[model samples]
Target: MQSGLALLLIGIQLVYAGKHSLQYFYTATSGLPNFPQFVSVGLVDEQPFTYYDSNIRRETPRQDWMAKSEGEDYWEQQTQTLTGTEQSFKNNINVAKERFNQTGGVHINQVMYGCSWDEETGDVDGFDEHGYDGEDFFSLDLKNLRYISTVPEAHITLVKVNNNKALLEQKKQYRTQECIEWLKKYLQYGKSTLERKVSPEVSLLQKSPSSPVTCHATGFYPKEVTISWQKNKQDHDEDVDLGELVVNEDGTFQKTSTLSVKPDDWKMNVYECVVEHKSRTIRSILTEDKIKTNYAPVPIGIIVGVVAVVLLLVIIAVAGYKVYQKNKGFNPVNASDDGSNSSAHSDPKA
Candidate 1:
C-alpha cells in the first residue's frame, strides 16, 4: 500500500514538472514622438524569438533558428496578423483616452497573454491580461470563464468582454489548445538552439579593497543557475547580495552574487563562490589574486569620459525602447469585440 501511494505522489509531481511556456506582448503608444506606434513581441521560455513594429511593418525573427525554420509565407502571414492587431490597438488607445477624459500626452496600452505546457504530463494552462499606464486594467479568469476588472475604470471593459459567451469560449480554446500546439511546434523547430547548454564564464570583481567581493557569471544558457558563497567549506548566506538575472544581447544570461567580509576575516578564512548550472559546478576562491578592481592606476579623465558615454547610451536605450519592460502599460483603451482582434496567432500551416 505504501508503494502504491508513493507511486501516486510521484505521478502527481511529474504532472507539474518540465513545464515550457509561450508568451506574447503587444504595446501601443500615443504622443511618443519618433517611436513605433505599435509593437509586438513573441517569446518562448522567456526568450524573445519574434518581433514586429509599425515602423518595420513586417515580422522578423530574433533568433537565427527561427529565421531558418520559417519560410517567407510564414513571415508574411505573421506580419499581416500583427498589422491588423496594430490598428486595433491604436484605436484602443483613442477609446481609452476618451474614458480617462484626457486629450493625451504620451499614453500607452499593453497586453500580455500566454500559455504553459507540462511536457512530462501533457498538462496545459494559460493566462491573458492587460495593462494601461503601468497599471493593471483587466484580465481573463480562465477557471471561472469571467473577466476581472483591476480598477473601477476597467469595469465597463470587463462587462463588455464577458458578455460575449461565444468569443470567451473561443479565446479559452485557443489558449489551452491551439496555443500549446504552436508552442510545441516552435519547440521542435528551434530545439537545437533552445535546448543547447553553454557554461558560464566566472569572475571575481571588487571596486576597492573596502568593497564587497562579487562573483559574476555570464554567457550561460537555459538561465537556471545558482550562485552561493562558502566560508571555510561551509555555506555562508549573511551579508550576501544576489543580483537579478540579466539577459545579454546574445541571448545568454548573467548573474552576480556579492559577499561582504572584512579584509582580515576573508584573509584568515577560506572563502569560495560556487556556481551550479545544469550538470556542471564551478568554484572560485576569493583571494587577492582573483579579484579584478577598477581602482587600478587609470587616468581619471578617461574613467570620467567612459562613464559619461555609458550613461548617455543608457538614456538613449531607455528612450528608444531598446530594452523592453514586461510589465509596462500605457493609457487604457476600450477594446472592440471582446478584444479578439488584438490577438495574434501562429501560422496555421502544418
Candidate 2:
C-alpha cells in the first residue's frame, strides 16, 4: 500500500512541475521582451528594403544613397533566387490547390507576387502597382511583418478556427499551466514549414470566453465570419451583437461578442455560439446564455430610403417611354391619314 501511494505522489509532483515549466516557457517565447516595435532590414539581392514597425517609425537611422543602392542590389539578387525557388513551392501549391478544389481551404493562386529587400525604404512601385489589390501583407496594428530567412526560406500562416466556441469550451477543462502549454504548441506547430526560421515565440496573447461569448477574429487571407446565437431548437429572436476583430501575433484573428440573458434562462433553454468563415461554420452550445443583450433593429430611415430610391427609378423608367413617344410625333389620326390619303385621292380623280 505504501509503495502504491508513493508512486501516485511522484506522478502528481511531475504533473505539477510540468505545469510551471510551461508557464515559464510561455513567458519567454512571447518575443524579445520590451523590444520596441521597430523595423529590421536585410539584403535580398541588393534592393532597398524597409520594415515598418512602431520602433522603426520612432527611430531608423538615415542611410546614404550609395549604401542604400548597394543594399538594394543585394536584395535584388536574393529576390531573384527566391523567385527561382518557386518550382518546389509551385508543386506544393498545385498539390494543395488540387486538395483545395476537392475541399476548399486556401488558394495560392491568390498570391500574384511577394518579395523582401534590404534598404530602410525601397518601393518597388511597380510591384505595388499590380496585383495584391485587396490584400494587406503587413499587420499594421500588431506591428508584425512577414519575414523569411536566408537559409531554408520561410513561410508562416495562421488559419482561424471556425469552431471557436468549441475551442473555448475545451479551454475550460485546462488549468493555468495547461493553458500555457497549449499556447506554446499552438504557436509552434500551427505555423507553415516555410517560416521555420522564426523562433517559437508569441508576443501577445488573447483568448475567447465560454458559451454565447464575444471575441475578436481575424485571418491571413480574405475571410468572412458571422456571430450568432440560438435558443432551444429555434434560433434566438434577439439580435446577436458583435465587436470588431483584430489580428493576432501568429497572423490569425481574434473577435468577441456578448450575450446577456436572465439566470432562469440557463435551465430553460440552450444557448449556442456560431462562427461562420469561408463557407464553413463552427459552433458550440452551452447551458448558459451569454449572447449580447438589448440589441436594436436596423434603422428604419435607411430601409425607407432604399425603398424610395427603387420606386423612383421604376417611375422614371416608365415615364421616360411616354416622353419618348410624344417626341417622335406619334399621333393616331396622322397615322391613319398617311396610309389612306393616296388611295382616296387617286379614286376621286378616276
Candidate 3:
C-alpha cells in the first residue's frame, strides 16, 4: 500500500528511552534495482543516530556523488564512527569474481552495534555487538569506549587503535541532540499518528481493588507518562505497589500501579487513578463499577482458577498412589511358601 510505503520511507521509530539504549547497524545487501545503490532504513530505534540524506540538514552525498565514489565521506563515516576496519570487509566482498565484480550480485553483509546506559549517572550500563567472524561477540563500556570484541581482527585494528573511544563520544552527542530533532521533523512531515496521544485506557483490574486496587494505564505515548493513586486530592501511597513501564504491540506503552485502601475507603469509594502525560492530566475514579472492571466476577474467577489448580494436583496425587499400589506387589513374600517347605521335609521320611 502507498500508505505503508510512505511509513517505511520515513524509517522505523522505536522507544530507545525504554531501556536507554542506542543501537547502530552497518549492512550491505546485493540484488536491488541498481545493484550497488545505497539506502538507509531505520529500525530498533526512533531515528538513526546520524543522518546522511539529501533532504535532511546535514552533509548528504553530493548530487553527482555515489556511496563508493573516490574522496567521499559517507562510508568512511560508517567505518570510522562505528566500524573502524570496514574497508577490509568491502575488499573481501568485492574480491575477484564476487558480486561487486559480477553482473548479478549474491552477497549480504551486516554488523549490529548496541549499548545501554543510565541517563543520570552517564556510566556504562552495558554494551555488545556482532563482530565479523565466528568468534564475533563483544562487550563494551559506553562511557569510556573501552571494548572487548571477540573477533581477533577487530581487537587488532579497532580496540588497539582506540576507534571505539571516538565513536562513543560522537554517538552520545548525536543521540541526545540530533536524533531528537530528526524524529520530530520526520514525524511531522509524515503526519505520523505518534503525535496524537491516544489517552491512556485506564482499567481497574485484579481480584480485589478496595483491598489492593490495580489501575492499569495502557496505550499512552512519549513514555514520559506517570500513573498514581490519590485520595481527597492528596497523593496516596498506602500499601501501594508500583510496576514497571512496558511496551505495547502498537508502539505505545503500558504500566500498572496498585493501591490498597482501608475497608471504609473502599465502601466510600474515595479513591482515584491519576494519569499525568505530556498531552493531558486525567483521572479515573476507583468506584465499585471500576473495581468490577476486570469484567469476570472476582470470587468466581479466583475460585475456578484455584479449583483447576487443586484438581490438577489431586489427579497427580491419585496417579502416584496408583503407581505405588502397582509396584508394592511386585516382590510379595507368600505365607504358603514356608508351610509348604515344612510339609515337604516331613513327607521325606515316608
Clashes of each: 5, 45, 1
Tens-digit lDDT track for model 3 on 1-350? Answer: 01111221112122444334444333333343433222222222322223221122132322121222324444353323222122223333233123124645444333333334444565433222332211233333445555544444344334332443444444344344444443334334333343445677777775644356678777777666788887877888777888755545344666778777665765675688888887688798867765654535763354355445322211110000011121211111121211211100000000
Off by over 4 Å in 1: 1-17, 295-343, 346-350
**RMSD (Cα, Å) of candidate 3?**
27.8
Over 1-350, each residue of candidate 2 has an lDDT whose tens digit, in order, gives: 01111121111111111121111000000122443211222111111122212222321212333233334444444233222222223233333333324343322211111122212332111010000111222110111211212211111211111123333222222222233333334224322421222211111111222233332233322223566667775667474566543323232333445555554674577766565655356566653233322222332233344335322211110000011122211111111112111100000000
* Candidate 1 accuracy as lDDT: 0.66
Best by lDDT: 1
Provide the lowest-lDDT 10-residue window in model 2.
341-350
Could you estimate the TM-score for every candidate? 0.78, 0.27, 0.42
Question: What lDDT does the true structure give each of the candidates?
Answer: 0.66, 0.26, 0.40
- The list of candidate 2 runs beyond 4 A from truth reads 1-50, 53-222, 237-239, 288-350
Clashing pairs in 3: 79-83
Question: Which TM-score value belongs to model 3?
Answer: 0.42
